[model samples]
Target: MLEVKLHDIGEGMTEGEIIHYLVKPGERVIADQPLVEVQTDKMVAELPSPGAGTIKEIIISTGTTVAVGTTLLYIEGEGSLEPVSEGKASETPKEEVPVLLKEKNEFVSSFNRVLATPYTRKIARDHHINIEDVTPSDPSGRVTEEDVYRFMKGEQLAENEAVSTIVEPEVLAKPISPDEIPFRGIRKQIAKKMTKSLFTIPHVTHFDEVNMTNLLKLREELKKEGVHVSVPAFFMKALVFALKDFPVFNAELDEENDRILLKKEYHLGIAVDTKEGLIVPVIHHADKKSIQQIHDEMKCLNEKARDGKLAAADIQNSTFTVSNVGPLGSTGATPIINYPETALIAFHKTKKVPIVTENDEIIIGHVMTLSMSFDHRVADGATAVAFTNRFASLIEQPNKLMLEMI
Candidate 1:
């Protein structure tokens, strides 16, 4: 018997919840075939079979979160499959086979799982109706409330005399209690990470306001030239230039070595607010990428983050991080630094406000608030202030970013 243990999938994942078993006990699977779907803190991933084998025993059930190296299941085989790098393309589950239009019973029998919302499933559960037994009226094979009701109605009819009373009592929705929710997924992992970052790092947050009057005009000009770019992309480019001047902010403290290790490369982590949690996908070399390239990559990463498709490589080795909460209507936030990284910057909502110019004339100007958090042990308040000042200057004069570009 070969043991299939849960390994680190990406971003030093310590544990993951067993989302579902693609293969069941006694089912034969080929090498490299996805045997199970596991939900890590960052993504939903499929674990491939180690070798061609019959699944002997499933030690861990669905929804159980287990640590790295914990045996999940046993395979009765020679175990010939070699492990690849974590989150390799081959590890992803195959694209679902396309199914043509089919009869209701045919569609139900062809798949092991039915597509249904939690509420729909709950309704079925309360009525003692098998979700599987309810034939979907929709072509997508989704079991809806009406479908469940239809199934209940069909079974309840005693020569059409039994109607309202039999259906009404069973259809009464059972409200799920708060205690019923098991705190054991990305939400749990986010809590763990936030706790670690807060307790370990002596956080010092500094606020800064940037005059975005020039940048707004520049963005419009670029858009007219058919060179579309987002404000965050511009901010990222400016951030890279700022990091070049204040390299100390783009560093990790090696506590064991008693030294701050300054990173030469700028792998910028853009914090994306996903449904799962806050997922920070890294742009491998932000300093090297053009504004357009950064924008394109950010779009791709953000989509992948929201869709839960980010790989281990996508979220690792970020020297510095930024959270653009402007679009989300955030005014400002004393954001926590990503652990071990020296600093993180957050861009908040911009408002057109009155500003006194160098000529002492009052004028309407666009201004955005920035909240920067840094590890107090590695850098001082003065250094953090200086860093943000440099960043603000770049944002205030966005044209300078074009000159600083590679």
Candidate 2:
């Protein structure tokens, strides 16, 4: 018999929750066939079988959390003899096995069940309503007190002949006991990294606005040529040039060694917002790619991130990072620096605003705000400001960017 064990999936990953078992006992499976789906701190991954054989026994049931190197199951291999314990099955209760399996299934399903606070449950009980009947609208899948009240009001409206009235805003603000969500998976990982970055790095933010008139015009011209360019693509291209001029921005500070590691290759990490949390996927050799190429790659990465299909390699080894909140309709944000990397750039919404030209004449122009956060330990304020100015210049003078494309 061959023992199948859970292996280490990635760095710092010690354990994983078995979301579901793809194979059952006595089922035949070939090498590389997925045996189970495991949810780690970063993403969900399918663990494959090691060799072709018939599954003999499942040691760990579904929804159970196990550490690395734990034996998950056993497979019958060639020349394997039947265990002597098979004859002693009468000693074990046949009815108990099915009961145990049912219990495990119930445990796994419980994780996805509706969650509500004690106060919210009390409100539902007082109104003689089933808490499970109420739908949760919170992103975290928790049923709030307001949700209970809304359901009760809806039912009242349907029973009475009178017209329905809007729910008062003041009622929604009533205090209630909050549900405590367990810190696990991607959300927990993000908290750990953010805490480390905030406490260890001295972050200084530089805010500036760019007149994106020429940049917008360039994008429109590209669109006419059958090339779709996004706002981030423009900033990515401009960032490449800025990094070349100011190498320090693309470097990491090795505090223990007391030296700066200036990266020769440019791997830009684009921050993607996912339902689970934020994940950054790196674009290898970004400096060598065209703006259109960057846009295409970003789309692919963003899709993978949202679908929880990103591999470990997709999120590692980034020289610099960029995050854009413009798509969410934000005007600006003070972004935190991604750890180890010296700097990060944030992009905000673009709008038409009045600008003063050289002749003191006021004219409307497309404007976007750019925010840069840098590690003071690695670079001073002047260096960060100079890099931002160069980046802004590239957007203002689109002709220079066109020349670089050649």
lDDT of 1: 0.80
Model 2: which ten-residue window has the lowest total lDDT?
104-113
TM-score of each: 0.78, 0.69
lDDT of 1 by residue, 1-406 (tens): 5678898888777888886676778776666777777767666677887755567889999888889999998876522244333334234344411221222224222125477653455457657788898899889998877899988887768536655546665656656556555465566777877899999999999998999999999989988999998999988888888888989999999998889999999999999886566888999998888889999999999987775667789998899999999988999889998887999999999998999999999999999998999999988999989888888888888767777763
Q: Candidate 1: misplaced stretches above 4 Å? A: 78-181
Clashing residue pairs, candidate 1? none
- In order, candidate lDDTs are 0.80, 0.78
lDDT of 2 at 28: 70
Which candidate comes out best when scored by TM-score? 1
Q: Write the per-residue lDDT of candidate 2 for residues 140-212, one digit (tens) a residue.
A: 8889878999999988877664433535575467787798864655566677678879899999998888899
